[model samples]
Target: MEGLVDINRLASGEAGRALLERVFQDDSERFLRRLRDRVDRVGIDLPAIEVRYQGLSVQVDAFVGSRALPTLWNSATNFLQFD
Candidate 1:
């Protein structure tokens, strides 16, 4: 599945819930509670974010748009170029 990832920033449970609600189309409050329960039961660090359905993991990445992509204008520039 195609997913968008914003640059890292501090997050709170409320924000996490909102994000999940918008992206996953599920009940964020319930999902958050369940996630917390699972983590407490297993005693491990819960993931900051994850997007998957069934068995397939969604691939997400952050990228600047065409203005940031390499073009004829930057073709001569080295090192900083992005394909």
Candidate 2:
């Protein structure tokens, strides 16, 4: 999708929030890599991205979803819990 998959397009309030949560929810490189791999199958040029954590940032060559982006969360919370 060229733009965001709006929260309203989702089936329900909870599902809509969940979908948004997943879109912004931070995960490991493994997770992002998997998503990128899936996007590669479609063969379109995915959006380039920069995800900043703490004071550090990494430029992702491509990403599968809209760049609606999200507010940074505390890293002290376990990544597993977010997953």
Candidate 3:
């Protein structure tokens, strides 16, 4: 959350996952703010990134989508849902 947080550029899904965990842990409030801002900008009707992140997980299971936390970890493919 300091410079740029492009999940796409990460070495792997595990790396991405670890980075996310770090960001979320460092400043959950700020992270949530950014997520909320992103969702707002994207014009998602759901209005909650936590929900989307939670529901989209196959490998990276989400514990509490509203809380913005990752659960299970499999791989980047499953993590990002590239298929």
> What are the TM-scores, per candidate, against the unseen true structure?
0.24, 0.23, 0.26
lDDT of 1 by residue, 10-83 (tens): 23467875775576655666799898899899999755887768877778544466544777654455335533
- Candidate 3 residue runs with Cα over 4 Å from true position: 1-26, 47-83
Query: How far off is residue 17 in model 3, in Å?
Result: 25
**For residues 1-83, could you state the per-residue lDDT of candidate 3 as single tens digits?**
68985666773688787977887688988888899899899988873355335556457545344335333553443557646
Rank the candidate models, highest lDDT first: 3, 1, 2
Please say which candidate is ahead in lDDT: 1 or 2. 1
Model 2 lDDT, residue 34, Cα: 88
In the range 8-61, model 2's lDDT, one tens digit per residue, is: 668368878786677666556568888889889988797789986797767754
Q: Model 3 Cα displacement at 80 (Å)?
A: 62
Model 3 CA lDDT for position 21? 82
Q: In model 1, which range of ten residues has the least summed lDDT?
A: 4-13
Provide the overall lDDT of each model, using Cα atoms, as 2-decimal numbers.
0.63, 0.62, 0.67
Q: Return the lDDT, model 1, position 50.
A: 75
Rank list by TM-score: 3, 1, 2
